[model samples]
Target: MVDKSARTPAETKDAGVLIVGLGRFGSSMALTLDRLGQDVLAVERSPGLVAHYSDRFPIVEADASNPEALEQLGAREFSVAVVGVGTSLEASVLITGNLVDMGTPQIWAKAISAEHGRILQRIGAHHVVFPEADAGNRVAHLVSGKLLDYIEVEDGFTIVKMRPPRETQGFTIEQTKVRERYGVTIIGVKSPGQEFVYAEPTTRISSNDLIVVSGHSELLERFAARP
Candidate 1:
């Protein structure tokens, strides 16, 4: 519902989301939200970058580090704002502060380092994501050849997909005792042909089956490490 035509702070209208910076993280977030049918307004400082994505979404070319620049874009009306200036800690912190001052309901920021993330949080960023770190962790799991998928649902818990360990193959779901032993739950099974089935206590796990389970990440790692 944001008035894309307004390029000055004098205009006021409501918007669902505001994205600052159009790097990989920013552009990806905007596109994904747009794909999910959300209204998104993106801003980038580079004219060339703005031109490239101009046809894809509504974008404004401006320095997001400046509070007046964002205010002119009606940033205060957006419910959520994401600051994605990964390479510039100053820009990220400044933009996050601007959004916070504007009273945006939620503000997410991208950080390239631990210190950068802590600073953003200290300055009122609601969430800080480390894309490189997260991607590296996933790659490490997949490289091990046992893990197929990993989704971190919370700080300590995750939903993981992996090939059953040698000792777990041929064991019934109940026999594995994942819940009792590891505080995990076997959500489902993916058979050889890529068929998925809701797992029950009597479900027999085959060597070729991929198990989908959810539990504390440490326990899941322990389960996967078993022979």
Candidate 2:
């Protein structure tokens, strides 16, 4: 077991994240949080994985599915915990339940299926994410060829990056009246060989310009589908 007190007072105060498992999802989450300057403690059962990432972040070899192991590592003190062991449903559920029993203020668990997600919610996971499913949905939208990139901010709302439609080519944003006509707002525009610029009334659209627009999902899809 690794010493939890190895972190200094300042690091401990900011290190409220406890992540279990070192699979793809867990590693990605740790890397992103680290990049954002968030302190993280990762627990994994695989010695190889622990060794691989030990230099990158603080990681210990332990099985989080065992509640005793979690307590030994001071899991209760963490304000946030993530159960990223989705390969085994039993292990995932057990870890989530342990976090809940420990009164973790925020518990995020990964679910492979709808049934798994419902189970996690029933057991008190504060948040459940279906990374594979969400990624598939996003890719489906991109494969349509209309949207260069898509982000669904919430139900029925989305922000998309797409090529300017032919009708808007060579026309100023104010003159095109895209907002008035499509009920979507162009947030920014990126012309080739230049940085992205915030959209303005006087900003003109070019045939090759890429635009970022935000609106209801259906409206944005219709706008992007323009000929």
The candidate that wins on TM-score is 2
Q: Which pairs in model 1 have colliding backbones? A: 9-72
TM-score of each: 0.88, 0.89
Note each model's CA RMSD in angstroms: 3.1, 2.3
Q: Against the true structure, whose lDDT is highest?
A: 2
Could you tell me the lDDT of residue 41 within candidate 1?
Answer: 82
Candidate 1 lDDT, 194-219, residue by residue in tens: 77998999999999898999988888
- lDDT of model 1 at residue 180? 90
Tens-place lDDT digits, model 2, residues 1-227: 67442343345543568889889999999989988998888999987888889888888788888999888777877899988999999999999999999898999999999999999999999999999998998899999868999988877689999999999999999999999999999999999999999999999999999999999988998999999
* Shift in Å, residue 34, candidate 2: 1.8
lDDT of each: 0.84, 0.89
Evaluate residue 17 in candidate 1 and report its C-alpha lDDT on the 0 to 100 scale: 75
- Candidate 1 Cα misplacement greater than 4 A, ranges: 1-15, 193-195
Error of 2 at 63 (Å): 1.3
